[model samples]
Target chain A: MYRYDEFDHAFVSARVEQFKDQVERRLAGELTEEQFRPLRLMNGVYLQLHAYMLRVAIPYGTLSGRQMHKLAHIARRYDRGYGHFTTRQNIQYNWPALSDMPAVLDELASVEMHALQTSGNCIRNVTADHFAGAAADEAADPRPYAEILRQWSSMHPEFSYLPRKFKIAVTGADRDRAAIQVHDIGLHLKKNEAGELGFAVYIGGGQGRTPMVAKKIRDFLPIEDLLTYTTAIVRVYNLNGRRDNKYKARIKILVHETGTEEITRQVETEWQAIKDTDLKMPQQDVDAIDNYFRMPNLPQRPEGWSQLAAARKADASFARWVDQNVTPHKNPDYGVVTISLKPIGGIPGDATDAQMDLVADIAEKFSNDEIRVSHEQNLVLPHVAIADLRIVYDLLLTDGLATANAGLITDIIACPGLDYCALANARSIPVAQRISERFGKPERQADIGELKIKISGCINACGHHHVGHIGILGVEKKGEELYQISLGGSGDEICTIGDITGRGFSSEEIVDAVETIVDRYLLVRTDKEENFLATYRRLGAAPFKDALYNETANAA
Target chain B: MSVKVLTANRLTDGEAVWLGANGDWLDHIDGALVARHAEAVAALEEAGKAAIKSNLVIDVNVIDVEERGTNLYPLRLRERIRQLGPTIRLDLGKQAEKTSANAA
Candidate 1:
């Protein structure tokens, strides 16, 4: 976790006070609702249907036990006794008071956190892989660059009032966990042919009304030119991005309109002017950041005689857990343990106050107290010793955090839809719960195998449905809630946007429709190893659509 | 059914407090300052202006304690700015002219 220095501390503290005054003015009628809207939004406050919602930034989804405890406290005292962790790794209090927001912000600043760019048309809280430093194949930690980008973009005078919101993602592993391909600017850290470290830049990827996978603007950019080039891209977007339609204000639209080649040329032209300037990273800065992410002292893998009695008789439960919850860690004995926030039939990405406390305690005891919130709505103990897995799992089980469904069909990603969000056309959480229940059986989920099911209440893509192997988008039909399914999208090493399968289904019919698709995959897949995505890719939406909609269509 | 409390940053001490519970909103406080023991208890009493409450929230509600706003001491900076009237509170001639133009 990055501690706030005086400069960072001072600015956030001052900004909180400024917002307090703004709130008072709005309350006292000194400022109109219109006048206070932007000011409040800048501070990550929004007026929803029922009450004010305060979005507090988690800063790349990294949190100390102390910070998590503080969030738990806020949930208990200020809002309802809980908080909602969002897709962007931020936490949102669905119901906060307009007047109390300043005080909330002040509390956030006290912990060196703020809601600064959680919302607004400006750059958002920069996101990276939840497993940034602790992943097995990491070439380097990407947080340092993310933090640097955060500082540079915090309130940059030029980019503050952009045409629309800008998002940037960075990754340093062979496998892209950061979903770098779907961001406005994606930086993949790689070793060039000459063995020099540099970035492969992709610009114009975004999700909205117009979804796009960013095109490669630069094949190789030296690390020193990272910020300079990023700035150039933003400058280009600001200069030429269409502000006429809110739907198409993203950089992706710009790239699509003026061809990626033209945008690349413009970015190159802009970069030529600033690449050698102050934006370049100092060697010391990079070294300093890299130092924070060095590998932990890990024990060597045991020289198993291939028959230590078949590994102590293989804990069947442990195998299931290891298969799902545990990810590849750099060290043989260490693994990236995903603390499942989704219990069977439970809402996605939600942790109770007690569960949070338990997680904090576990982090302190076995995992060094460093916890991360994933964009997929799961908490991760990025570096957990293999021997300590059972204990962590047992503790998690007691807290309803131990559902052995990490990437399985039951591990869903859903946004707070009509249940909480004023912007949603339908409720997303209940639908997710229904589907999870239908596929809640461990055997059923295991049989289904490696699936990404994402549900979004609206087109904002908060649930990241556009990138799910199976995407469910809930919309309103007349006054009823309807869901549309898309398939073949992914947010991993090889990213692709999902294509819509067919017509929408009603709220009640949606779950059955989803089950229909899952069953189709089970029947048609080459083997269990082939995921829903692979199957969808091998045989396009035609087959899955035919299976899911044929009967209902025939009836119609 | 969930309720979210809206706290404010008190100018006096730069901390957070429940509006009516921690302090009072004076309809007619013409005297000195008084201290209250428990803010949670005081909030139940007639304290300050309220915005909204008692609504639909199905998901888990988070109150990140780290975000409890600064240590509110309650000095009301807005009222102070208004009462002082920006270095020209006693200028009755200008006020009269401004008031008269409005009347006209």
Candidate 2:
């Protein structure tokens, strides 16, 4: 974890104080709601359906145990005893008083965290693969470059208020766990044939009303030009992006409206103008940032941890949990444990105050004092020793954090739809809850295999429903809530926006529709190993569509 | 004519509050000032403006409601959640508050 220098401390403290003054002015009737809307938004405060939401950034989804503890404290002290982890790797406190925001921000600053770019039109939180440095297939840790980009974009004058929000994601591995394809700018860090570090840059990808997979703008951008090239891309969009309509404002819309070749030409021209300037970081600065993300020292592991194997053999539930929630680490001795936030019949991505505190304790005691928030809305102990897995599992189990369903049917990603969002047309949480309970059986979920079920209340796609293996979008139809299902979507290396299967189903009919589709896939799949996504891709959405709408199947 | 009620989140605490007959904000929806006619809507809006001026609440707006006999119910599902609480957690929000009060 990177420690904040004196400059960082001073800068954050000043911003907190400034926000405090602004909030005071707003509360004292010095500023109207219209005047204060942008000011509050810039500080990550949103006025939702019934209350306010405060979104806190977890840069690259990395946090220390101490920071996690502080987050728990915030949830306990300021919020409604819980926080919702979002798809962008941020945590949103759904209820916070306007007067208390400055104090909350001050507490966050103490942990070297701020909500600054979390909600603004500026470059939002720079995210990377949750298993950034720990994944087995990573070519290089993407966080160093992410951190550099974070530093460069924080309060950058030129790009602060673009046509709309801009997002950037980076991945170190060929397996795109960071969902780089669905970002405004997606950087794939790789070593070229000559062993030189560079990025395969993709631009103008986004998921919203109009979803797009990023186009490859530059095949191999040299490491030195990372900042300069990124600036060029944003500059092109900032100047040319449409301001006439808010819906047509995102960079992805610009790329879609303007031909990719012409946009590439414009970006190249802009890059040529700025490549030699101070935006290009020197070698020493890059090296300094890279050192902060280096793997922590851990003692070498014994060949096989017999105790872990024995525990698995002893307890079938523990074995199921390990199989579902744990991923292989880059270091063979250690394991990355995902703490499922999705409990059956519970709100997805929500961790209670007590659970947060307990997870923080577990991180401190057994997992090298580091924690990560995955984009899938689960928490990760990225460097837990395999030998300590049982105890860590036990601790999480005691607090209801150890749900044995990760990447399974129950690990749902959902936005706070009509439940909390002012913009939502219908409810999402109840639908997700129903789905989780329907597939609550560990054996059943394991049989279903790695299925991604993402739901959103509206077309904003905050839940990344556009990329779900089974995407459910809630829409209002004739004063009733209807769920529109899309299949064959994926946010991976094989990035594709899902195609809508057919007519939407009523809320009552949706869960059954999902189950019907799942059942059809189960019967149609060659083997259980072929997951829902793989089966859908292989056979296409026709079978699944037929299963839902066919009167004969419904009768049966 | 369709009936309506003015609702807003309290500025200080962000609790869901509704305009009352006495020109006050009430936490529970049962005591809300339901306006059956257009004139009553004007009165509720006037009270809402005063509340805003007093910094009592933010984002004040009217929502459609149905008056069944004497009891009132919100028409839109979103407003119902606001009046009650999160559908997922019955034990957590205003619904719990109402339940506990009735139990007592």
Candidate 3:
């Protein structure tokens, strides 16, 4: 909903012109492939296994109907008729030409979007809750602050060439759909006892080779010092971060090596100088950005929409949808509808161009023409009128986008593994497909309840396997694809790295192994309401680990 | 064969630079000559070498590179680095292109 102002438009246009020139040099033979790789990657372009992959940033996972349609168009025209929505809420095209990138970027800019900061060791896309302003538990909309941060960091004078890439996430709501804990810097907006706005900051959180939950560095930072404090934290890492070894270069490692207390001191020392400077939020600027994120004016509910409920009260299928797919809204009459891109047995986040267009049309007609990209790789219609639920559901149904399992077992997150990615050591998409097929039943998924299953091709954790309630990491053992499972990993405010359950499994048995773990939890757990995460936390991995590796139970 | 109007943005200065006729980058822009933008021209030359070796060269011919629009010196430098194998030391063979041409 944030329209690009003149300044924003000018800035993007300038970037486009510059890239177009670079492309020409590349084609003309002045720029060699080696010379241009980082330059291209900074714009979110990658030469994958078979084709050039271009990742376009869907910042904070929000999009308008027009932008969605444009993406659909790009998919049909340039790519293989679809785009894969990544675990980070970005859309990646697998078949873009090196020559066509500048053109693709120009089109994106027309929609007020670009691939800037999507990759290359810079502060990557600033992700946020899909239900930012509309969620019932939201303290305040985090997007205005996010947008301010975005502009400040875009082509920032310093900190661009850091040791490694950085990721930041913000969530205003009590429930963390943005997965704030796993980000490099996670900010949770909160109103203190005195009703003043502040942020609960988490640092040193990531899901790559080393997975760790962020340590809380600041309990509640005042609103005035948000950017200054964040800049300080980044600056401390930038100046002292390990550049000798690429693997240990992340700020997460720095925090881990030097402890959170020392890191906090360093950040505070850096902040003392810049706190009152231009980084401080100007009233007019904050107000201007905040205006774009303001809630839509909706009238009071036409009484008994909830009572209208389900025509067939016993229709458990419909009830399942209402329970899982729908989220409560700040406004009574409106509900945030999560359209699951993960139809059972379909690729985790790959949406067909037709499906994208259909969703765009639905957003424009039924919802408020606004769509959101959840970090879990699902689509959100944040302002759907409760009265038109059935109509929207029917439309979503035709497109195979109407799966009600939003947080349920079936909404798995998986990366484009060896199938597309050059960095992967083993296959991920196939393993995910295997799991999807195994747990294809909607009723089965609903019974298992809200379980987060994530798979990464390798340790990069693009699939966010580090945060999954049941995490699966695909690795290679003697040239054969194997999976290593981790239990109790979470991505909420209280984040935790999953403990490895035991030895790896062959690809053939991995999916079944995962299902066995879930089924065992279902049988032994106390009640139906207790989710996988809750059960795991109460008892730790003993029960689940024994159930899987103990030869007698394993045979069964 | 191309159908769309494309735009490119530079990551460093966030300024517009012309794609060189030689297939890499150019120091001249608008009415500004390479001599006028001396620092930028030199940086582009360095980047040109890096870009040439960044990935498998594509869309443009690898041979007859000057006509294809890429720098010859960087191509030679990339080969030298490959020979040395991950040793960050710069191969003196790299600067031979500029020196040889200047000497001639």
What TM-score would chain A of each candidate receive against the reference chain A?
A: 0.95, 0.98, 0.97
lDDT tens digits, residue span A323-348, model 3 = 78888898878888999988777787
Question: Model 1 TM-score?
Answer: 0.82
lDDT of 1 at A523: 88
Instruction: Give the alpha carbon lDDT tens digit for every residue of A403-444 in model 2.
Output: 999888899999989888989998999999999999998888
DockQ scores for all predicted structures: 0.02, 0.67, 0.03
Q: Give TM-scores for every candidate, taking all chains together and pairing residue i with residue i.
A: 0.82, 0.98, 0.84
Over A413-510, each residue of candidate 1 has an lDDT whose tens digit, in order, gives 99987655657777788888888899999888898888989999898888999999989898877657789999999988688999998899998899
On residues B1-104, what C-alpha lDDT tens digit does candidate 1 reach at each position? Answer: 11223333322221222333323422111221233334632443323223211111111111111212332221332222222211111232122334566789
lDDT per residue as tens, model 3, B1-104: 11111112233212122344354433222121122244655554554445435532332212111112222211222222221211111221223333566779
Candidate topping lDDT: 2
**Local distance difference test scores for all models:** 0.75, 0.90, 0.77
CA shift at B51, candidate 1, in angstroms? 12
- Candidate topping DockQ: 2
